[model samples]
Target: MEPAADMETASASTSTSASASASASASASASASASASATAAVGAMMDGRLLQENALSWPEVQEICKELEHLYRKDAQKDAARVRALARKRKEISAACQEKKNTAQQQLNQLLGNVREWEQQSNTAKARRDELAKKLQELEALKREMVAQLERVRVDEQSSKESLERLLDTYETARQEALKFQLEHRNEIDRAKHFMSLYAAVTGIKWDFSGDSIAGEIHIPRTQEIVPFEIDSTQSNDFETANALWAKIDAAFDALDNNDEL
Candidate 1:
């Protein structure tokens, strides 16, 4: 049993190795067949004629030789032309790229300059705004002060006008009172003057007592003598009457002198 098992294992291992070897041989054979077929087709193409000679004969061998030489020359010329064209295109593309890069760089520089100029203008505008605001504030404060001063002046003017009106009223009242007092005393002054005139007239005449019978004869004095004489009636009655009349006359004279002086 151990021998049979060993024999079977060995058989299986031999079968696997043989299968791998067979696959490799088949692959090599396929490659060789493909190579041979390609070579046969090439030989057939090489044997063909691309153009005709002077005669109707095929001239396959000679035509093939001539065509091969023409194809080789044509291929070399085309290769040289393609190399020149490629070189020209490369130069053009490089130049175009360089121009684009220069234009982009110039545009970037201009944009940066413009941005800086804009920032400077903004700063100037801000400064101007601040200055204007300060000026406006000052103007507002001045206006408020002016208004306050105007109010104060108006109040002072009103007070002065009121005081002037009161003074005028007081003066008018004093004048009216003085006029009323003068009117009330005018009639009394006129009556006193009339009585004085009558008394002076009666006294100026000479006495007529001789017509009436009295126990004693009465003597008459001259006007000049009686003018300076005193009556010999009762002492109190005669003295009092004469003194009262003199006082009234003196007062009237004094009032007239005062009026003249004024």
Candidate 2:
């Protein structure tokens, strides 16, 4: 009996130990299952948080992230090419602008030269004009002087002509007076000669009484007249008459000579 009891007690103890061991194992399994479930839940929450933060569904996020990476690489490559192209364009524009500025400067210099040349020509033209004006003035003055001299000469010529005309008139008057004086002198000489001839005829020398009586009568008698007997001195009468006639002739000659002298 003792052996059987001991055996039973051992059996009981073994059974109890086995049951406690089974219970502990079961609690451990439950704790392990709870931990696994918590771990699963935490993993699901992390996945949801990651999906919310990325703002995409799992498959869409994966594709979008891959495409974004590819686009970024492409954009970087395009930016590099664009930068190179812009640099090249800038260089070309700079060179073109510099060339344009150089051309403009050259044109400005040429224009300045042209302006200077034009100014010089203008000055020369002005000087020539001034000289021409001076020469014209001098010519005008000379012309005026010549005109004045001509006028003076004309006046003098007119005065000389008037003086010559006056002298000619005076000469003509003197000549006319001389001619009148000569004519008067000739007339006086002719008158004296006629008087001398009449006196000589009146004083005849040989006086015949019959001829004388007949000559003195208004009507001459055709027959010869007889001498008067009372005429005692006929010869003395004739001599006296002849002497008076000679004296009258001499007196007449002297009168003619005196008239010629005067």
Best-matching candidate per lDDT: 2
Error of 2 at 143 (Å): 1.9
Runs in model 2 lying further than 4 Å from the true structure: 1-63, 175-262
Q: Write the per-residue lDDT of candidate 2 for residues 80-122, one digit (tens) a residue.
A: 6655655565565556556555655666677788889999999
Candidate 1 local lDDT, 191-234, one digit each (tens): 88777466555434233344432112122223132222233334
TM-score of 2: 0.45
Candidate 1 clashing pairs, residues 3+ apart or interchain: none
lDDT of 2 at 167: 94
Residue 221, model 2: lDDT of 23
